[model samples]
Target: MSLDTQSPGLLAEPQAVQATADGGTRLALRGDLLDFTHQPEWGAIESDAVRFREDHWLLIEDGRIVGAQPGSLAPDASWTRHDHRGRLILPGFIDTHVHSPQLDVIASHGTELLDWLNTYTFPAEKRYANLVEAETGAARFADALLAHGTTSAVVFPTVHKVSADALFAAARERGMRLITGKVLMDRHSPDGLRDEAPDFGARDCVDLIDRWHGVDRLAYAVTVRFAPTSSPGQLAMAGQLCTSMPGLYMQTHLAENRAEVKWVHELFPDARSYLDVYERAGLLNARAVFAHGIWLDDDDRALLRDSRAQIAHSPSSNLFLGSGLFNWRAADEANVRVSIATDVGGGTSLSLQRTIADAYKVQALQGERLTAWRGLHAATLGAAAGLSLNEEIGSLSEGCTADVCVWDWTQGSVAQRRHELARNLHERVFAWLTLSDERNLVTAYVRGIARYER
Candidate 1:
């Protein structure tokens, strides 16, 4: 466990759907369509997994994908199409793990995971007890995410019910797909931040689940602060909630740092490894997402694969907090679902563009290359699949909500140069990951509605 820390074209304005003659709302965006059909290989780009079509039309009807048609379209008033031929369109980036409360603590100068939590993270989260504070913070956090071309995320709010509700309400107001829960830390935390002292905060979770979960594209997670902060009874209670609530997700930290792993061992002397603590508590499942799985043994990796739980690779946080680099290739080879995330506050930024660049550096340091296909897949469909929400979001398929981003490769002088120097689609797109940021985003849509723009 640890503490730590686009495009072009369209006008930067929100839009409401236009009505057709048949009394239905339709919006079609014409651009270069790109999305992953499946997870690509670890180091190399996969041809079959990628679906890239130039000058295609992504048809959206009533906020759902109807189809993606190719070639020129007839000038019909049945739908409104946004021309973005030079821009790229793909499923919005899905951040599997992040801290909404910790947004204030981002880039705060701190040493390591544990110390950073006590110093910057706790004080900031404590302020979330105020509804106004929580509401304002959540609004900024949600807006910041959309501004960076992320339409969906699994977030970590503070332990306060108000904090969790504020985030849910913010996402709801904007129609963004989001999942979050009140942080559960019954012990090992400051007075104001810990949950009602010692019962794992299940009652609060139930209250929040009833209020926010499954309401307007928002979901609830059984959020454990991490292994160190949660007592045995608390972890067991968290597991019980997962069992009682069929579709509820479980999120927490794992073997992120050397000291944290050692701490987990000390806390749970009978457990074989850090992951074993959660597994014994019945927390291992397909819906469970553990971040920073960098210290586990081969056996732990195998267990995670067999249990169908996923690991979120947070490279910037690992780098900023001095946590070790994650062996994403190893976990994928072991058949474990691995997704990339920002893990912000503990990480440095909410931009997945910068996060992926850091991921490439981290992977390259380990002698493995992260191709554009593999990296983008990890950010989008792979993350959605890991959270078992691939069918609902994260793709441009019929009936899925239209969470999409239109991006430009030629934003600034350097990106324009990179676009010119590129030889193929892969190279230019790879340059988008490295050379581009939120400024290149033309429009980011949540369910066919443009929520953010350049």
Candidate 2:
């Protein structure tokens, strides 16, 4: 199907057809179903309940999951069934931190945190000021996410309100659940990327929220570029936007690089730490998702836990930028919620599988292992919780949007050979996580409809 096909209604109804089994017509899954529930550690990790039947059935009617279980035959129910056997079914991956404007610069070279933004990131983002460019980029970005099995994302757009509008429009067109905001930076950014004033930025944000938020599956996030880029007035305005907009999510960078930390300390001398800058601005709260909490001190962790704010741990970006390893265990001990993310552009890959692999390696350096189940949970359910979007798009539960991904574990020669030696599900899952990239994604669905089917 072409990407420009007619956009569906907010709760679009799926087409209905008849299914047959045992010489009787009925509603059922077209093939075997594999579902994952609860991470291996169960209690230690977040609960991720899932259910899918083998050659079983899901009766989807009116764009909602009516039933999902194993049964012999039902002669009365009319439904169109999809056969997804030999494929793993899981919730669509939620990317907690990513820059939609950075789609073209994902693998650029050689600049540390702040330098990278000034050198390459900001200039690239400035292109989104044009509505046509923003729309095209938004469509491409959304397509890439769907192609890679990322069903939802908390995205950062350029400082232009049109950037957020373009992304939201594209997401709505594709029937995706996306949260995003126009980057608010009143100072310390290039001329084209900087806003006129804090109040003006706030006004634009309010406008975008009114237009986009709650329109279908989209949400609005109050995005601050970072403490260093935003003036005190701008930060306060971002805080005000958060306060005024109920259920709005807050996103910003924090303590990613050593030099960045030193700069933050120099800029906000009175604040207790880098996090304290946002905390004092009323920007820290339950719906807040801070990226790269690598340099967080003990008190910082405590404060994050106290506020119930979540962290988007971008291991790939941290490694690429030479930032220190994140202390996941320390954050865990402090009762902080953490989710894995690909801090793309700064992060090297768009593949959640690669992000999971990098996260496993990062944890290993800290003398810990992020298990296959735990990594998968972080990519899906855990990340959704971090974004405060768990109820809508996290797992394969009945009533949840049928955003699903099917993986071809043995797609490549290497994978096929590795599959031959794998003995168990866990081992196979581990191998896929470690070795699989975007090539392994066989098909991707958004809201019960196929967005990309390989």
Candidate 3:
């Protein structure tokens, strides 16, 4: 076997079943279908603000939701039926920011952002140089995401080109929509992790983009580790790649930590702020996603808003690293798109439910409350919009992909109690978001295929 196929056990094997022929495939999912038509803001009451259809049925054919309606009957007798009685069916979670190589080091104690990267993150990521090891890590990481009900993600693979290939390969085999790139860092990182030269880094990114961008469900991103890790030449190449490639995504860190922010300012004294580093590099655009935007000032926020750039709010990672609270409300007020994320390794959990819980707490600390509807929307439709992927995987709307999660609201004790006393949909959803984890996921589907089942 080739190196990439040597460790197949590292991935969670799906059940032995053949996919039904494309046109002949029709699967009917019956449950309480929950979908968001728009970003749901907090309110004293819950109405049709967020759409939830009890006793609903969705028709799936060729991996897309052909039709969805509030009824119990399938339109045709040839359809396969999945009867999720009493469970809640919602759009699968979309995590906009996560590091696949750092799954092993998740929850590791560290001093701060820069120190954390030098001490634990870089050392761990450097191991992905081995194609076999990278494949194994990618498989495990992808499985972990499925187990936690994430059907799509914007990922950061290691600087190793093989790392990006391995991750995109595994995600392709499972039909998961993953957007990632070969990390472009030409300075300040360890010897093994940093690119040898600026042109070499740019060439690797271009090659990876050629090999994987727009292939299958995989899309390419131009990833600079951050402002401090990339030299000006490397950043310019990354920006050039972003502008040259159509539909290409640009992802990197922003004002995640105070020290990191100060370092960026010191490193690029000509720039106005940390955001300006990428802005001046011509990397700010609607397709760009900056992670952990916790320390942005008004000017920075305005720049982001003006550029139509997006932010991946990694509340769990921010809290774990003692990074300052993100002013998501301010971003929203400024019309800057913000989506929830699990910045793994630096972040403690892969589960979006846990991230949502952390986000609730984080926003609470800022005296800004996020409703359960809004929080769920952030991980689903809101995140999809942030990543410029709304038409594909974020909702239960007809013609959308069948990436969905079935939640057993009566499973855990807290959920059971909520099920008993819950008079409204909002109350039950709030309880579940606050109290649920991976255990609450009865099953998770990606493109109409069952990848994880409890």
Across residues 1-454, which tens digit of lDDT does each residue of candidate 3 receive? Answer: 1122433322255433224555446678788888898887654356465888898887788778887776656556667777886888999999999999999788787568888998899999999999899999998889889888899999999999899999999899889999999998888888898887637487777888888889989999899899898999888888888888789999999999988888988999999889989999989999999999888889999999998888999989998999989988898889898888999988899988889899989989989888888788889998888877889989998889989888887665656877789888888888878778887887788888777776
Worst 10 residues of 2 by lDDT: 7-16
Model 1, 2-25: lDDT tens digits are: 111122322234586778877878
- TM-score per prediction, in order, is 0.95, 0.90, 0.94
Best by lDDT: 1
Higher-lDDT candidate among 1 and 3? 1
For model 3, what is the C-alpha lDDT against the true structure?
0.85
lDDT of 2 by residue, 66-94 (tens): 56665455324355556655655666889
Look at candidate 2 and give me any clashing residue pairs: 29-57, 31-55, 32-55, 33-53
Each model's number of backbone clashes?
11, 4, 0
Tell me the whole-model lDDT of each prediction, alpha carbons only: 0.87, 0.79, 0.85
Query: What is the TM-score of candidate 1?
Result: 0.95
Rank candidates by lDDT, best first.
1, 3, 2
- Lowest-sum lDDT 10-residue window in model 1: 1-10
The global Cα lDDT (0 to 1) of model 1 is: 0.87
Candidate 2 TM-score versus the reference = 0.90
